[model samples]
Target: MKIAIISPGPFSVPPVKGSSVEHDIDEVTKMIDPEHQVTIYTRTCATYPKSAVEENRQFIRFPYNGPKPYLRRIISHIRKRKPDVIMVENRPIYVLTLKRHFPKIPVFVNMHSHVYGSPGMISKDKMKKVVRRASGFFTNSEFLRRHFMKTCKIPAHKIHAVHLGVDVSPYQVAKIHYSIRKIRKEIGLKPEDRVLFYAGRLMRAKGVHVLLKAFKEVCEQDPLARLVIVGGTGYGSNRLNPYVRELKQLAKPLGDKVKFVNFVPSAQMPLYYQVGDIVATPSVWKEAFCRVNLEAMASGKPVITTPRGGIGEVVTHQGSGFLIPPKDWKAELPALWKLLWSAPSIRTEMGKNALMRAKQFSWYATAQGYLEVFETALKKRKAASPPTKQDLRKTG
Candidate 1:
């Protein structure tokens, strides 16, 4: 099967950092069978050449001048390659363009989360039109799938859910123990400090302020408790923004107990997991599926996340980690204390369980799942009514 995956415009293939969706695309493309040819169309960056091929996978870049120019470039490229199935990540608005030029091809939109609230993306009405017209829709979590279905009035059969995955090898318990102390020291963590790690965007919606508030309470109860924030302004931005400033101000009272490492490369994230006693992702909004939880679990560390969106699907409450309700620090405080300040044996057992659970999700499995969706959608598209010349000319 020939596949063309269109990633979001913010980053290129083999993302250095802050491109979780692209990373997902890269990982899945790598594990795909050699018999199947894969071409990933991503945004061009200074680091990447126009075209590069590795193994069965090929990467092609296009400039992100604007939606009009981007769509024009995409149409020109796809007309040449004419892939069997086209899979686009996020940005539901792209479906209109694909349908206009490649009416015969099956197009699947893999949504990480709904972007309705985000600035300058497609509107809800446009997204609904995309959902109705596309061959199929997929989301990283069931929560996202259900939400999309309900919001767009699409049938359940049109949407599928595949949990996000992590490369569990580097985060194995053996590897973590090998450099535990060294990584801890490198991150400015003392031997006695019990670190709570948070790795994602520093935006308030991600619950950074809430995490700081909860950490302040934890520190008041236990001075040895520490919080390590490991992210910049997410979505490929390198510079610190006002949100980062706000978080810094929030953590000021807590002083050096809160450590901000800015943006750590995705390749080096395992070290942060190893140094943390517990991973916290207290997102106020409903996340589709957070890769941070999977990475932490793979590294043999317990995670304390909110019970919103697809998080419930990823975490088993009190089994692998605690799932506290979002923004309810009253509930969050106790859970944090229990995991971080309580018995060492409890944390150890939970970490062991987390590692076991993490093994269930793998990039290979995710890739295979995506292939199944592509095949099913393609077959369905083939069986449906033939595309009329009128359909090909229709552009919205």
Candidate 2:
């Protein structure tokens, strides 16, 4: 089968630094059956060629000045390819555009976040049109699938929940080559320090400020407690913004107890994960699906995160990590941090459980899920359509 995947034009197909959607596309395409011809349509990057093939997936890049021209070029190429199925990544508007051009072809919209489907970005009427026209919808989690059903008035049958996966091999290899003591010493942390790590955009929505507030109380209680915040204001962007300034201000009283590591390359994230005793992703917003939770689990570190949106679907509270309510994070986080800090055995056990859980979610499984959805949508479309003249002739 020939599959044409339309990537959200903001980033390149194989992400240089960060872009979870792009990274996901790259991983899933690589894991997909080699027999199936998969083509990814993405924005041109200075580092990569205009056209390249890797792991049986072909990438076609186009210059992206704005959404209008970028999507127009993609649509023109997609028409030429005449793929069996078209998958639009995180763009509901693109689904409508594709359906207008190839009304009979099965077009599936993969919703990685609620941003595109929200009333703020696309109106209720247009969202409904997308639901009506598109073959099916693939959400990263059941929480997001239900969200679209509630907000866009999409039918339950039209949406499918497919969870994302993590590549645990790198984390596994990192464990063998790198020691916790060495990583801590390299990062200016003492062997005795109890580290609480946070990785993601250092924005208000990510709850970095909340983590800082909680860490302040933790520091007051436990002298050995340390906080390590990793990431920039945005993906591949380290420019300090007002929110980052606010976060720095919040961390001022803590002094050297807090360490802010600017955006690290995606390849080096495993080493940073090893630097912490416990990973904290205190997200206030309803994350569609927090990849941090899976990455931390893969690194064999316990997590303390909010059960917002699809995050609850990923992290099993008390089993792999603690799922503190966002509202009660101030009280709960410090207490949980202290509990995990004091008990090394408990932390080790939970880390083991986390690794086992992480192993279950692989890129191969994720790619298979996508393939199943594509096949289902195609079969449904074929069954609904009238028999072709060739088919009628064959029957006659």
Candidate 3:
């Protein structure tokens, strides 16, 4: 099975911003390589240095300036490569390109998120036009899968749900333990400080503002807490601390209670998980799949996250850690305090449980799942009639 994965616009293969998307593409490509030839199609951004192949994986680069007609450029690459199955891992634009360029191939548009109101996905009408025409579609969560089907009217069978992957083995193999104070010392954190970590895009929908508010309360109530926000700000770096600056301003009321560092490379992510007493993800919007939560849990740290979005499935409430209501919506801070001031024994137990649950979401299992989808779609493509205009109208 020779498979070609077409990642959507402006994404560098190992992705500078969204590690999950890049990591997903990397893992799937590697997994299928043993049994199948896999080629990944990603962008050559201005930032992407000269490509020198290092790992078993290869990075194939192409020029892309902006969103306009970039999909044609991608399909042009795919048609030349001639993959058994072409997997496009983003939506809208690529879907349209598949319709125009490679209408014969089994093009699978795997969607990770959907838009609501506010100038969504081309026109909802035009998307349905493509969804009606494409061979198949996929989303990472049952939540998103249902939404895509309901909103787009694509059959449930045509839309596949592939949960995103996380590497659990590295954390398991490199697992370490330390007292809260000891962990603090190791990370240059203060011995007296209670560390709360938030890593991922610093955006309003990520609920960074909400996390800042909660952390401020956590400090006012506990007096020993410090918040460390990691990962690059999501919207353009030029965008005025934007939502992030506002969060910082709110935290200024509590001196040294907040710290913000934009962009932590993926390799050093485990350290952020290791250094925190409790990890925080307060995303107000649907996160589709919270890979950071999986990463944190893999690092054997208890997570504090809001149950809204697909993360409710990712982190079980009070099971892996605590899944509180939205930070702004919640009425009580005492529960947060109890967890913050918890005894060493309780905190250690929660961390262990978090890791236990994290093991359930392995990169191996995720890769295997993707392989199944690829094989299934490839088989369908092989057996089907040469895609005709009539085939798009044929109802299941």
Candidate 4:
């Protein structure tokens, strides 16, 4: 059961900031059998030592001097410490390297999201080749599985749709230390104020701007409504990013009705969700799974999100929460205004529904699903190609 998770050369495992892919890798690795050896390959610019082991898992971080240097370092490490299976995060180009060098080793290319931005470095044809060669593909949502099948022409059997799960303990209703009264008082929210929370990167694609625009209209009509944004620039970068600047401009006219809190640590995120009456993830782009929705649902708050990609799979329309059409903030406005202005009993009922729905997803369940995929891929690889003299020598 030895596993090697190859992370993209941008972030570390158990990402200190916002990295859904790295966070999933960290969680799944922890859920795997402690008897099995699991190692993660990360990229870092820090001056710390190159390798470290913690929590029954090993991490080998390589310096990101340049593409060539990083690739050389990664190749060197993989050659020396080959694992029973290779599980790679997104960025198919890197997996192509493993396929080229260790063709027999079963490789699983897990797709977290396809809409992170441009894939400027890797050509389309080369990426398709990587998809075709992978022993199996893991997608976080059924929407993404279909996308891969359509775009890559990968066989349906090769793709597995396993939804991501949230760490629900911190968000449990009884386990939470911060009560609604304390959270509201700390945030300067009045007893009568209604809060709409958004906790994610301030990037435009995340639909922060859409939320701001809709909130402005909602606030104009309902002065008691407030929007609380809790996240800074993504990818652990502290610099004042352009998206942050743009979001500020969009929120300027709205004044203090819109509050922006810089990146809150993962441990304290539950407080923000507990304080708010509603969680709004107005993302314009098609999210693969929309972890924010699940986190909010776990925190016992209904979400008003778009029915893009796998988001519909998580949030039921008017059941646990309301699902709006993508990029249709105008449509979102009426629903948000109605919900924010609704009676306390109505909101509470929806929150109860959200909590019930959130209970169905768990990190342990997600880990088991991934292990099943790994076992199946290994079985398929063994049947397709028995060990040859070269593979046997390499194993020896």
- Decreasing lDDT order of the candidates: 2, 1, 4, 3
Selected candidate, larger lDDT, 1 vs 2: 2
Q: Point out the worst 10-residue segment of candidate 1 by lDDT.
A: 116-125
Each prediction's TM-score against the native?
A: 0.91, 0.96, 0.86, 0.89
All candidates in order of TM-score, best leading: 2, 1, 4, 3
After TM-score superposition, the amount by which residue 266's alpha carbon in candidate 1 deviates from its true location, in angstroms, is 0.7
Question: Where does candidate 2 clash, by residue pair?
Answer: none
Better candidate number, 2 or 4, judged by lDDT: 2
The candidate 4 region of ten consecutive residues with least summed lDDT is: 115-124
Error at 66, model 1, angstroms:
1.8
Candidate 3 lDDT tens digits, 1-396:
767777665567776655566667776565544656667767777766534343444566677776655566666767777777777776555666575766777677777677531135567677777777777777778888887777778898888777776777666554553343454554556766777888888778888777777666666577777788776665224345666568768778876667666676676566556667788888888778888898889888888888776887788877777777774423444465565477777778878898888878766676676778778877776677576767668843
The prediction achieving the highest lDDT against the true structure is: 2
* 92-145 per-residue lDDT for model 1 (tens digits): 788888898888888888888878413357776777678778988888898888
Residues 1-396, candidate 2: write the lDDT tens digits.
899999989888789878889989988888999899999999998989999988678899999998889989988998888999999999888877788789888998999999988888888888888989988899999999999899888899889898888989888778766465676776689877888999998888899988998888888889998999999988889988999999999999999999988998787888788888899999999999999999999999998999888898989999899998778888887778767767878899999999998988888888898899888878877898899999999999
| Cα displacement (Å) at residue 302, model 4 | 0.4
lDDT of 4 by residue, 204-234 (tens): 7788888888788787678888888888777
Candidate 2 vs candidate 3, lDDT winner: 2
- Give the alpha-carbon lDDT of every model: 0.82, 0.89, 0.70, 0.79
- Stretches off by above 4 angstroms in model 4 are 44-50, 54-56, 116-121, 173-187, 238-243, 326-328, 339-341, 384-396
Q: Which stretches of candidate 2 lie over 4 Å from their true place?
A: 178-186
